[model samples]
Target chain A: MNHALVSLACHAYVVAALVYLVYLVRQMDALATGGRVLVGTGLALHAVALVGLFGAQGGRPVGVAQGFSTFAFLLLTIFLVVDVCYRKPVIGAFITPLAVAVLMPGLLLDPGHVMSPDVQRPLLPVHITIALLGVAASAVATGVAVMYLLMERQVKGKRFGLLFSRLPSLEFLDTLNRRLAVLGFIALSVTLVTGAFFSSAAPGFFWTWTSKQIATLVAWAVFAALVGARSFGGWRGRRVALLTMTGFCLLLVSFLSSYDFIHVGGGAH
Target chain B: MEFLCIGLSHRTAPLGVRERLALPEARQVELLQRLAQSPNEAFLVSTCNRVELYMAAPDMNRVRESAREELQQLGGPDALEHLYEHRGEDALVHLFRVAASLDSMVLGEAQILGQVKEAFEKGQGVGAVRGELTRVCAAAFGCAKRVRTETAIGRAATSMASAAVSLASKVFDGLKDKTVLLVGAGEMAELAARHLKQAGATKLLVANRTLARAEALAAEVGATARPYEELFTLLTAADVVVCSTASPVPIFTKENVGAVGKARKHRTLFMVDLAVPRDIAPEVGELDWVHAYDVDDIQKFVAENAAARAEEAQKAGVLVAQEVARFVRDRAVRNGVPVLAQLRQRGESIARAEVERTLAAIGDGLTDKQRKSVEAMARAIVNKLLHEPTARLRSVGPEHEGNRLAGAAAELFGLEEAAPPTGAGGPNVVANGGKG
Candidate 1:
């Protein structure tokens, strides 16, 4: 890709982030509308940059980069849809910042890592897709948990404000967290099972007592406990919110470490 | 203008007095017309618990006297002891609070707004509500909506429909296998039927005055539609009977319901009457297993909820008061607009007359074009002189001398007595001319 296009896409993402921040503070209808339009345009530019990278580098790098980029975009699309679907748009105040953070690094990060032809196979894309989807769901669950916690505090303290008016109730947020947790668990389970299946060695060999495997296992166990507790013991509300955040933090570590240790290919910067 | 709100509510009057003073739906137009006889903007809000006459008139004493007399036509002159009348700012604040649901028997209730809307429409039909009363009522509904949207006042609060189901649940141990008989296609009955369905009631039967209307509600609530004639048969088979209709006379009585209860082998029947003039006879409550409750019982339940949530109610009250103060402050400043406009016009006219006379005295040196320029310059000077004061008028507080100055201008220019400003009270004050 040309330097000019990447720089332009980078600038658009920054402007979109700042516009979304403005939406958080002012909540002016025009500002909110502008923020959405800017981000949408940035996504379009990002898509074009991905296509250009694919044309230059061939298919492998493009596939890997598109996997992460699609997950990020999917989360963002859900946030926008949820903002409009719910009468309260204040949740965007939380979600747009997370989106901005992801996009900022994504635009700057080098997607130039190459993979050996042997490592590039069908099972690898499947693993990456499932893991990224799990991360996205965990991210959503964490965001919902944070909102629920804030709203629950305000409602308990009886300090009602625009945020109190905007955020969903504790019950609703708890239910949403549980649902997202279930999705994350299912995706993570598929990713872990497929990665183990395609590793070319035995189970202990893939595990290898590595930090990436350990972090992945920890996140899986936490989410598993959350789902189990919710189903059997009816753990809910504040407890569920706390558990969801814990699992997301572990998943975040697992992803960053997996990228560092697994020597996976990168693409479409 | 002074405002007087006089009527019998569930708080001050018993069921008997409320019934006697209750304005039937058919007589709403006539009563509103009669209330308008005293040169007042009259509106009547008659719900099951409240039968209030809200009037705005220039003469407080005369309007209050006539309102009391009018109320006596139903309650025999003794109703005055139970009536409450508020005047001026207090009256204005009270109406705002009432419309905002703060003064509702059920705090933060949504039903009173509908009742207020119905009263406003009825008053409009009779040409009794105009000016301040119209403005106040409309403002009230707008304020109520704001409260509902802005506060947690509605969270876990039992609506009338839910309340009916709760009452039914109390009569029957569980509604899992029981049948609910919804009589009439009215809003309350439909809502109650939905609640019953939600509670896992095994079956539902809807009987209405018109079969088509019954069928519609039945389909919506997943209830079986039955003709009005099948009401007694349905009643015998059902565990709960929720009756709400626009019928003028009693639909269910001791004779009709007693036979049905007996035919069902004295099985328990929970009867809920949510009608205005009473659907079931008061005597039916005496039966051993026939647990009966009317709208008054619902009022009692709502009052209990209000009492339990009194602390929250106080918080809501603070919000309502704060909002009311903000609205009134904005309204008072806006009210200065027309007065300032008149004052500016008056000042300009005086300045123009003085400028023309001075220009005419120096006529020998002045060209026709120069005179026209001078006239234009003088008009600009007038605007420039008044601009600061006009802007200052908007920020003037009630305590400030600027308010007195504006008030004096209004009195002198007859703007004070002019028609109400366009949008004054409530958030959607635009709905009513702003006399709020």
Candidate 2:
């Protein structure tokens, strides 16, 4: 039943994404409202599925699938919050499709254990939650950054097509990107601190100079530079957008590396 | 009765001739009063581009001659040569075309509908628009509204002021929080400022060479007037700047705007240079964050938009034709209403008289309940008798066939000599006057 619910939620997200895509093309108010409602419903059902999975696992995600589902839920929650606050429906043309893409893996794949029972410290859930939240925030920032670049090109080229008309101004997209990046940076900072504590507590894991650790550190440095440059260096527009996208790509690499390392490292326990 | 529209439009008359025939508010009221004295319902529309009078009268030649006389008095013998007359169905079609803006100088401009409505209201105020004219004007208004919504006639911005607003909206998210700087309080600059203000720009700064003229325009537009020397300072704070000075040279150079860009932190600045001599330097547009559009650019956009709207105007023309047809049919059906009422009244009165006579002959032989049933039966019989003729009368066409059928029905039912109700002449008036 829980698996079925996850599948159903994934389907809802896909439909919502498709509706928003149509809205981007047509720019109709009815389609926008329908997309928002579908996304909201999908989020609610996704939360229920995650809660059921956690309850079955004794109040924690058991494996990669559950971990990915939790991340997708948090990502959608953050996006909806921002969408509601800003009332920028055009951003849904980017974020909703990204949400569907992110949730597909967890919906289709079996969630094999990544950490043995013996190595599961109490801080593991907190570490993973903060880490996934950081990733979700970065994903949102990346989506906004891409929109900024597209809008900038349109303005500079004087294309003024449907996409140009539907998207927000370059300045507005840039501001949203900067804000999301700052938020993601702070969350990643907390995640790193908590992950260090978890590494010390867990039996097999260590904060040594492993490949995954190096990748995570590199990803952390990229975001740190992004936030710093934007705040003090007057860095903005296309340059900042490119750097943000690059940092997000690095974060993806770091996340994949950590997933592999966790599976291999779990064998020892 | 006869319907007639005698007028001169931009197509037939020069601007000088049109101006001579144009009626001011007081003069229009006087004209309507004179028309009311002649027992004809009349409406006068006198805009800068056209001067027209629409009237429904009992005599076609008399109405045309009087309308020509009125035009001759307002204008002169030269105006008489340019005046054109459309009678009956042609007159109504012309009115619908006018209201829908298909007949406007600018193919789909929106102002003419308001002008027509104002003319109608003026006629109503002086009791010159009784019933038929009221219905015709109301239908014309509906037809205009339908054309506006169903087609893209009024969708594009075809004027310089509107094109500027459209350009600004394309650049900014919205104008509600943007600041506008108006340089040189010229008429075009004031018009653009008003357009921007209507589009929701929050702050307006007016700067002119003379402080008093700037202050006057500023007060009129609810803006702040700045000194001419403070143009650069105002540019620093403005998101959109509209310049329409009568200067011989460029007012803002590339260097001046580039410096303001720095002061504004590289925020976007939209500049509209409506002056013929180009108030802002063309090179200023090449500067980062400054987008400058001179008069030629705005005019080019307006012309392009007007051409696009002309295509949509074709669709609106079709809609106006359909609406006119529907209104004619509906008017035909309404024409049958009074006659149908009189026929029913006549049948019911005869039925009641016969039933009372029969009841008296019985002399209380039947109970009160029986008598009541008998009366209801009489009413039902009368209704059954008149239903087909009533339906036939209401279903007649708007053409001569319908008129002939109505006349035959009135004569057969002995209603031809009976006086109609006070307001019952409305449909007859339109039918007679609207038929060629």
Candidate 3:
């Protein structure tokens, strides 16, 4: 039943992602409504599957597959919330496909290893939640930033094509991207602080700079500079969008590297 | 009733000829009153480009002659040469085309629909349009709306005034919170100002060399008038500026605009110079924050949009043709109404006469309930006997064959003179005076 639910959820996400793509190209209200309903249903089913997986694993997701699935679920949740609040259907075209892509690995790859008992301490859940939320917020920022760049290009180039007309205004997209970046930064800050506590609790993981940690630190520094420039230098529109995109890419790299490192090392302990 | 249209448009008439035929509001009302007295129903639509009269009359030649005489009285012999006439289905198609903007000088212009609606309303007010004219006008309005929604014919701006607004919208997100400044009170500037206001520009400032003219235009447009000397200060506050001064030299140079840009904190500015000699300096457009378009640029934009709409207009033509065919079929079905009404009246009167005779013969022996039941039976028999014929009559097409069948039915039923007589009753008597 759990496997069946997970497969259903993944298929629903793929269908929703395709509908959103069509909606972006056609700018049809019907397609947008259908896509929203599909994504909402998919998110519900995905949450149920996650709950089942956690229950099966003794009240927590225990492996890299589960972790990736949780991250994808959080990403989709944030996307739906933003999409509903903003009424910008165009962003769904970018975010839904990203969600499906992130979830694919979890659905295809079996759980090779589980986390050690020591690593599954009380602090571990808090660290994972904060980190997933942070990643989800960053994903939203990246989607919004992409929209901002497209809108800015159309405005600056004086070429109002179909994509240009479909996109939200540059000002709106820019503001949304900034807000998401701020939210993600705050979440990442909390995650890093929690991770510090968790690392101290787990032996052999204290203050050690692995490739994943270095990549994450680099992504954090880039976002810090981006937020700093926006606040202090009035950096906005195209430049801010580009910086946010760069930070998101770096964050993605860091996430994948951490997933690989943990799985290759037979789960962190 | 037969539909007929007589008019002179830009296609068939020169401007002077059309101007001569143009009727004022009072004159149109007088003509409508005259038409109301005639047996035919009629209404006139007089715009700058065309003056047309649409009517429902029994005789096409009589209505045409009367309309031609009226036009002759208004514009003399020269206007008569430009006048054209359409009859029946052609008239309906013409009205649809006009309302859909297909007949407009600039294809797909929106003003024609509003003008058509105004004429329709005026006709309704005067009781000069009813029955068939009412249905035709309503269908024309529907077709116009369908054409607008189903095709991209009306998508782009075709005039300079609207082109300016379109360009501004392309540059900015929207005009809702933008400020527009008019540097001169020229006709083109007033047009652009009205377009801007319609597009939801929040504030408007008019600056002209003549303060009185500026104030007059300001009052007209519900805007404020700033002194010509205060143009520079106004420029800093405005997001969109329209310049159309009569001055031969440049109104604002590159240096002055650069200074204004500095004061504006590098906010985006759209400038339209409608003047021939170019009101704003060409180099002013080179400034980082300022986007300027001269008259030629606006004209180019209008031309390009018009060309694009021309393609959509072809698509609109197909839609209009489909609507016209549907309307024709509907009108055809309506032609069957009178025949059906007459046939039913004939059958009902026969039933009534038979029921009365039988009731009188039965006299004192029968109960009132029994008499009523017998009468109902007689009426039911007549109704059932006439059912198939009446249904067939009502479904007849407006074609010549349908008319021939209707004539045969009238002859067979002796219904040719079946106009319901006032205060009279018989098996042959019709209902509602056969006005159907």
Candidate 4:
């Protein structure tokens, strides 16, 4: 597998996201179409690039470097395909940036690395897949939730104009947010269960207390509260948006702070 | 052909002028007859907001002038300025939109189709509607129905009756136990009454000038029919009074309604005069404890309904354009029949005459079998000669060479000189003709 092509694929996605963002502002449908086409092409290239990397690594690349790259790229490809197929162009306003944000980190890091024992575990691939899908679903929920809040504000003030016009109605946005959150919640719970099971079986082998763990826990709590509020308290609209954004912020913290803490020689178990 | 539309609407004229122009059942028959006598196809569509006459004639300006003259003769020319006339396709579109309720005071109103149907039937009886006017009206009605079924325009976001009920709710806070007195037998009045009843009005009363008519309406609406003698007495006790009648004069004067308010100890009264020649006097609106609203007051709320349904109305416009294109194409084909027949006849005559002359000259040299073979060869030559032009003309549409071919062939064959072209028939005829 060419390391250069993987980097190129990630960079192409980022460029596509930027183009889509420009279209969101200019509202040029032609630019939007171009962005969609670029994203689609990038997704196909990214999928092939992952396959190449997997082939180079023997069978399934479930180790540290390859696992992260595969997880990030696979999640993004799935998200982009769903987003494009749904005919909801406005969603790109939120999702494209998120896609770039997740993929850029892995792209910047070393593409190839010697496989470690922790990375080559039996349950590693399943764990990464679950975690990646959970994160992707949460990202979508976060986007819809933000849109819901904006729409709710506009509705309350009765100042419906461009932002309000571009977004789905409060009812529709809230519904989407809730549904995505539920899916993400299920995936997160499965990942958590798998992680706990593997840690019990191979004690102290895959343990961590890095800044990443804390931030991920915080995200989980925020989303859990959101789901609970939705079911029991009937929390929706602006409230749901606030919770989603909070969870998303935690995700960013986990991604950034873990790298920082590890550089500062933080504990791994 | 002239596309003249004239009459009073809620916008240009007040209820008084509108009522004067409003054609009652008896007067509509006579007015329709008068319009038919003038060589124009007249269509009278009378709704609560408007009383418009859509006509088709050869001279549109002359038709417009005559429409004003007719209106003046019927309801006086002082109301002439309130009239509006749209010509040709504009008129056609306007009528289609109106029948579809896109141009209605309440957009996508279901009531308009029935009103149009009634107008069509009345015009048919008086012979004011024939040809294209009748077809356009019926098509417009059908188009309106399709728009209603296909789009969410008339899904009752808000209607005039609902608006009235909403206002009544604001006045009463809650409509429960309110007594409603409907002082007319018109469809609008009946609809308003039904809305009030749905809003939880306990008692309903109908008081018209004609007791039997009032009784008939009251029976249908589950209301009591009080005689005209007890009108003021009933008005005093009723919490709401909805007035919509075809009366020439004012039905509820300030003196009578004001006096009734005094007798009722100044209990608050919500009076909705849904009439054209306003049932309640304008001054009565200022009476103590009487909250009176005329048709004009309802315009803003009704306008919102129009705004809400604008998208669906736009869709209907597209449908109308599609239908119009189809209609014109069909008419062109039917009109080209004579031309096609004449061309075929002329070609056959030329082929038969030449063949006969040749055969006579060569009669001694040719046997019977050989003569038959020559006749067959001559027929094949005629078919080959006519095939290309006939195919080209048939393939041509109205927008392109079809009209040109028809006109050229007509002149070449002297068909127009022999017989004049007929008028455009009603939609039913066109639809059936198209089917054939």
Candidate 5:
């Protein structure tokens, strides 16, 4: 039953992604509104699927599959919050595909057990939630940054095509990028602080410098630089956009290469 | 289908004749009232570009002569050389095109529709527009609306000032927060600046070599005057720059604009240079974050946009033609109405006489309820007998002389002696005039 809802939600997100892609080319405001409504429907279905998973697992994620599912849910939730806060609609063309990609494995993969029984339960869940939230914010930042760069190119190149009028203003996208990057950076800091306590409880795993830990710390550093430069260095537009995308690509590699961080001395799921 | 239009538009007449023939509100009402009696319906449309009289009467030729007489009297004998005439379907298509702005001096311009609507409303007020006039006007307005929504005929900018504003909107999305710098105080620069201000570019700074002239023109453009020596300083802060400086040499260079890009953090900048010698270097346009448009470039864009509208207008023209054919067919069908009425009256009378004779032969053997049923049955029989002929007449179109079909039916039935279709002196007309 849980997997079925996740699968339905995954299809919905995929369809919404297609809608946004069509809207991006057509430059129709009506199509943009349709994309927003489609995303809302996908988000509703995804929330119900997560609630059912929460009930079945007693609030603890099973393995990488459930974790990916929750990560997509948080990402979409933040995506919608930002959408409401900023009137820019073009970024959904960039954001929804990421949700679909991240949520696909949750529907297809069998979620085996991923945690050590000796791990402190409360701190582990909290640390996982914080890390997922940070990654979700970073993903949204990446989508917005991509939109900023597209608008920047259209403006500089003087094409004046559908994209030039359809995309948000460069300044608006840049400001949204900075806000999302700062939020992700703050959440990553909290996740790292909580990680020390959760991993040390599993014995001999304290600061073990595993592949996942190394990649995550590196991703965190990149986001830290992005947030710091934008806030103080008057850095904006294409340069920061490229930096955001680079950090997100690193996070993607780290996510795909490693199992859930809760696998403290546990076998790979 | 008896609709006729006679007038001299800008196409056929000079401003001398058109202006002389243009009617004031009182004169339009008087002319409409005077012509409405003989024509059965009349309306006057008098604008700067055209003065036309539209009327629905059975005699298209006689009405055309009378309308020409009225215009010639108002605009003198010179108006006769300029007058053009259309009748029936042709007249209706003309009306629809005029309402949709397809026949405008500036194709797809928006003002003509409102002017047409005003003429229509004024005609209705004086009891000069009704019946066919009302139907055609309604159809014309609907056709105009369809052209507006179904095509991008009027979405393109047609003027220099408007083209610049539209291009700015595409780049900046909206200009409420942007700064615009005007680099000259000429009339052309002020015009473009005023248009930008209207498009919500609230912050405008005007700079010219002569400070006093700059300040005076700045007041007109709703901008503050800045010193011309501080041009590069203004460039860094401005999102858009309209340059019309009368300089022989290029005042801006790649090096200067390139440095400004870094100073402004490579923000998008739109530059419109309207000078003869070109105030900004053409090479400045090559730099990233800088867009340069001169007079020729802007004019080229406007022409292309207008040509695109013209292409869309062809689609609108097809829609108007379809509507015109439908309206003509419907009007032709209405021509059969009076003849059908007379035929039914004749049939009902004959059936009643026959039924009364049969009842009288049976004497007092019938009850009151049976008598009422007998009368209803007789009426039903007559209606059944006339059903096929009525259906055929209703399908008539103007090209087939639906009026002649009505005349033939009347002559065959020995009903009211209707006028011959060759001329329109018809007595069996639905008189609906002088009633608003």
Candidate 6:
């Protein structure tokens, strides 16, 4: 039943993403409302599914399917909250589809997977939560950067097509990108700190400096520079958007490299 | 009652004819009042581009003749050449299109809808709008509102000044935070300055070679005047620059823009060059700080405006058609009203005559109480017999079946007066309404 909820939510997110893409090309109130309402419904269903999984697992999600489901949930929650606040559901064209892709592994694959009991350290969940939060924020910023570039091109090139008119102002996208980058940076800083403590305290887990960790460090530096340059140096426009996009690519590399698969019923404890 | 629309638009007439036919406030009230006598309800929408009068009545011939007379009197000899008229559903559709701006000179413009609303309000005040015109206008306004919201019909503004402001908005988030610098006091510059001001540019500066002329233009537009010598300084402070000077050579150079780029932290700048020889150098546009569009480029945008919104406009047109269809179908029920009224009148009179004869045959045995009861029973029998026909005509039918049934009932009842005017109910547009 919980998987059914996840499946339903996934379908809703897919449809919402498509509607938002159409809206990006040709804006209309009905399309925006469709996208918003579907995202809202999917988020509600996904939240309930997550709570059900928590009850079944005694608190945290149990397997790889549950883990990625939780990650996709974080993505949708962050996206919907910020979109509602900023009134920019157009960016959902990028974010909701990514959420659907992330949720697909959990929905399509056989459900059971497990890892070492030590990998389930209580502190690790906190780190995962903060890190996923950072990832979602950075992903949203990346989407906004893409929008900024598209608008900047049309304004510079002077095409003035439907896409040009449908897009929000370049400055608005740039401002939103900067704010999201800073927010991601703050969340990521806490994530790195919490992850370090988890690594040091958990048994059989050590600071090995894996490729994922290196990429995380690199992404963190890029975002720090972005937030720092924007705040102290008053940097804006294309440069900021470019840097945020770069950071997002690095973060993607870290997420994919670090995404470990477990043997089905690997037997915890 | 059938709806009618007659007059001249920019499509059918030139500016001279439109201007000659345009009605002022006083003239509009007088015209509406004159046209709105008992049986006819009228509305007049008089703008610079079009002067159209909408009316509804059962007797369309008399109304059309009066409308032609008014047109001839108001527009003189040219009114006959450019006149077109729409009747019945066609007139209602035309109103829907006009209110949605689909029939505007510049398709999807925002002003026509407001002008239509203003005319409607004036008609309401003049007491010239009743059943049919009121229902049709209300639907027109609703369809306009939906077209505006459900489609991007009004997103593209199609004038040079409006294009500049719209492009500026694409770069900057809003004009309220940006400063606009006008480099000349020409008509184009003055026009763009007013547009920018209307678009909510709080800080506007005018700089021209003739500072006095600049000051006068600035005063007229509620802006500050600056010396042309401080042009580069103004450029540094301003985010949008409009150059309309008559300079033979380029007034600005790439080197000057490159130098000013650092002063403003390379903030995005938009410049519109409206001069004949081009006020700003074309090379200045190559610099990273600015995007400059000359007169041709702006005009190109103007020409592309309608084509760009073609898809959305098509969507709005479909929406308007659907709304018009729904209104027509809803209004078809009213077609049966006259027939039902005639049927009730004939039946009640026949019943009264029959009841009196029967009572006379029954002789003096019938008391006053019995006579009243017999009369009441006769009226009840007529009403009961008319119920099914009335209900069928009023409801239960296909698109045009209600009206057809009503006409058939009128014929069956031998009510000659209930028939509609011949050749008048069909939708028709006559180009030669004005007889000189």
Evaluating just chain A, the predictions reach TM-scores of 0.79, 0.91, 0.91, 0.79, 0.88, 0.89
List TM-scores of chain B, every candidate. Answer: 0.83, 0.63, 0.62, 0.84, 0.60, 0.61
User: What does the interface RMSD come to for each candidate?
Assistant: 15.0, 3.4, 3.7, 14.8, 3.5, 1.6
Q: Which lDDT value does model 5 have at B331?
A: 58
Which docking category, incorrect, acceptable, medium or high, applies to candidate 6?
A: acceptable
DockQ for all models: 0.01, 0.11, 0.10, 0.01, 0.14, 0.37
Clashing pairs in 2: B1-B433, B2-B433, B3-B433
Q: Which stretches of candidate 2 lie over 4 Å from their true place?
A: A56-63, A112-118, A200-207, A210-235, A261-269, B1-158, B246-250, B275-277, B280-288, B291-312, B315-436
Clashing pairs in 5: none
Q: What tens digits encode model 3's per-residue C-alpha lDDT throughout B330-415?
A: 65444445556877777888889988888778778888898889888988898888888777766655343344455567678777
CAPRI quality band, candidate 2: incorrect
Worst 10-residue lDDT window, candidate 3 chain B = B425-434
Off by over 4 Å in 3: A55-64, A115-117, A200-207, A261-265, B1-160, B163-174, B207-211, B228-236, B241-265, B268-436
Query: Each candidate's fnat, in order?
Result: 0.00, 0.16, 0.12, 0.00, 0.25, 0.59
In candidate 1, which residue pairs get closer than 3 Å at backbone N, Cα or C atoms, i.e. clash? B422-B434, B424-B434
Global lDDT for candidate 1? 0.68
Best by TM-score: 6
lDDT of 5: 0.75
Misplaced by over 4 Å in model 6 are: A55-64, A203-206, A262-269, B1-158, B307-436
Tell me each candidate's RMSD, in Å, in order. Answer: 19.8, 16.0, 16.3, 18.6, 17.0, 16.6
Give the Å shift of residue B262 in candidate 2: 2.8
Give the DockQ-based CAPRI class for model 4: incorrect
